[model samples]
Target: MRAPTPVSASLDDLEPGDQALVAEVSPPHELSAWTAWLTSLGFEPGEPVRLLSRARPGGDPLCVRVGGSTYALRRAEAACIRVWREVARR
Candidate 1:
C-alpha cells in the first residue's frame, strides 16, 4: 500500500506529546513582526519540533521544543508556525 500523505497544520493544533516538523512561519499580517523572531528561535522549515504541554484553565501558552531549546508560546504565537505532523514509529 502507498504511504499516507502527511498533513500540514499550525503548531497550536498539535496535542501535548505530539511531534512535528517545522513547515513554514507565516504570522498573520498584524503579527508579522514575530516572523523573524520565531525563525531565530529555530522555528524554520524542516526543524524538528514537539508540543510539550498546555497551560491549565486556558490553553493559552503552549510549551514546545524546537531544536535544542524549549519555549512557551501563546496560542496565537504558536499558530504562526505551520508544521507537518510526524507519525509515531513503532
Candidate 2:
C-alpha cells in the first residue's frame, strides 16, 4: 500500500473553508497545559475538522469546526496543532 503523502501543516497555514483532518499536535512541551486544552476540544489525530473563518484586522483568531462543535482559536494556539489536508478524489 502506498503511504499517505504528507500534507501536515499548522492551523496558521490553513485558509478559510479548508477541510482537514487532525494529524499530529505537538505542544511546545509534552503533557503540558497546551495539550490539555487542545485535546478537550477534539484536536486529536483522525478527527474531522475544517477552517471556518478568520477574524478581521488580522488572522489572530480562527474559527474551526470539529465534529459537531466549533471553536475560536488564536494564531499562536492553532499553530501548535498540525493537520492534514483532505483532498477530494476525482
Candidate 3:
C-alpha cells in the first residue's frame, strides 16, 4: 500500500478557515516558556488545531480551535508550531 504523503507546514502559513494536525511545537527560543505553555494547551503531536479567524488588516492574534476549545494566539506564537497533512485546496 502506498504510504500517506508527508507534508510539513508552519501554523502561521495556514489561511483563514484552515485546519491541520499539530505535528510538532517548538519554542521561539531555547528554554522559552512557550514550550511548556503550548503543551498545557494540548498543542501536541497529532492534535487537531483549526484556524478559525484572524485579525483584520494584519494577521496578528489568530483564533484557533483545538479539540473543543478555542484559543487566541499571536502570529509569532503560531509560527512556532508545525503541522502535517496536505491541506485540501480551498
Candidate 4:
C-alpha cells in the first residue's frame, strides 16, 4: 500500500506555544513579492518555528519565532507559510 500523505498546516493555524517545522513559503500568485521577503525573514524550509502569541480581538497580527529572530506577521501573510506539525510517538 502507498504511504499516507503527511498532513500540512499553515503557520496561522497554530496556536500560541505550538511548534512546527517550515515546509514551504509559498504565497499565492497575487502576492509573489511575499516569497522573497518571507524567506529573507528566515522562514525557510526545515527551519524550526514557533507561534509566540496573537493579538487579542481580531488576531490580525501574529507573533512568530523563526531561527534566532521573531517577527510579527498578518494572518494572511502567516497563511502563506506551510508547516508540518510533529506527531508524538507512542
| Candidate that scores best on lDDT | 4
Tens-place lDDT per residue, model 4, 1-90, is: 454345589999999998999999989999999999999999999999999999998987999999999999999999999999865443
Per-model TM-score, in order, reads: 0.90, 0.83, 0.84, 0.88
Give all candidates' CA lDDT scores: 0.92, 0.84, 0.84, 0.93
**Weakest ten-residue segment in model 2 by summed lDDT:** 1-10
RMSD, every candidate, angstroms? 2.7, 3.8, 3.3, 3.8
Could you tell me how far off, in angstroms, the CA of residue 70 lies in candidate 3 after the best superposition? 0.2
TM-score of 3: 0.84
Q: Is candidate 1 or candidate 4 better by lDDT?
A: 4
Give lDDT tens digits, candidate 3, residues 17-38.
8778999888667648987898
Rank by TM-score, highest first.
1, 4, 3, 2
User: Which structure among the candidates has the greatest TM-score?
Assistant: 1
Q: What shift in Å separates residue 19 of candidate 2 from its native position after superposition?
A: 0.6
Candidate 3 positional error at 56, Å: 0.6
lDDT of 1 at 49: 97
Q: What is the lDDT of residue 89 in candidate 3?
A: 46
TM-score of 2: 0.83
Instruction: State how far residue 63 of model 1 sits from its true place (Å).
Output: 0.5
**Stretches of model 4 off by over 4 angstroms after superposition:** 1-6, 88-90
lDDT of 1 by residue, 1-90 (tens): 456467899999999998899999999898888999999999999999999999997998999999999999999999999999845443
Candidate 2 residue spans exceeding 4 A from truth: 1-6, 87-90
